[model samples]
Target: MSAGRDDDAQGAGAPGDAARPKVSSVLFLCGMNAIRSPIAEALARSLLPPTVYIASAGVRHGERDPFVDAVLEERGLSLGEREPQRYEDLEDGFFDLIVTMAPEAHHAALDATGTASVQVEFWPMPDPSVVTGSRDQILDAYRDLLGRIEQRIRQRFEA
Candidate 1:
């Protein structure tokens, strides 16, 4: 993965025509932080306003994904030195919302945020790393995943 400075520029959230709740902080979670969740964290951090704190974790820690870096690089986003971490490894300890990309992470977030004010949402996303085929085919899988997550973010935050 290539290294680049984290983009701190604020992004437009919901448009003036749409109505959505204000979310100050968000956490994206997946079975392993390697792929989905990290992609989400990077996208959200760039796609949402700077006021929205963004982070990601997994049910279990895993190595950072090169595909994730590749896919994001296509959009001019870079992962830099960010590393994969488990849910327990987050230092902030709380988020206004938790978006889980896999069943395991969803359950973990639910259990971890039990009875708390934080909202947990399950976004069942396929793991692109599981794809098998030519390099281009595998990359297609990642591109598809990235599009889906981007669409979700727009709908939920930008309407």
Candidate 2:
């Protein structure tokens, strides 16, 4: 296990627990790929096993947020190579799990998974873009958003 990891945060499955199945592919979605979904994707990339194929998208296409790049830089994470993509842009739209961070994304994921066996989880995250304040305050909002998504990712995948 990596240093500073706490397995008890979410009561994740114990070692050798047969009840939890390994997740192969996952999709993270939000209203825009600018902030939430991409951050979640980067967090998952750092935490989850490489065997898991992880990708993120928005309900509609959006430009990458520089605040996202700046905040993630504080964690030594980068999104330099990732271009924002919409659900319709995914070449392989199939995934074992679709994690949505916004209401619109949740509904879209539901519609996309109709008649399919995929699992859809709604996380209902806040959009930090709506926040207006000083430079520190704005960065704080992004940091808070990053923390929330990081916690959720750790809870669901860490053990």
lDDT of each: 0.79, 0.82
Best by lDDT: 2
Tens-place lDDT per residue, model 1, 1-159, is 112111111222224423335779989889989999888888888889998899998888699888889899999998899889989988897887788888888778777776776766677789899899998999999999999889788866873
> Over the full model, what C-alpha lDDT does candidate 2 score relative to the true structure?
0.82
Q: Please give the lDDT score at residue 57 for candidate 1.
A: 89
Candidate 2 has its poorest 10 consecutive residues by lDDT at 1-10
- Tens digit of lDDT per residue, candidate 2, span 1-159? 222122232333234445556779989999978899999999899889889999999999799898999999999999878889998889999887788888898888877777676767778788999999998899999999999998888767762
lDDT at 153, model 2: 82
Steric clashes per prediction: 0, 0
Top TM-score prediction, candidate number: 2
Error of 1 at 106 (Å): 0.5
RMSD to truth, every model: 8.9, 6.8
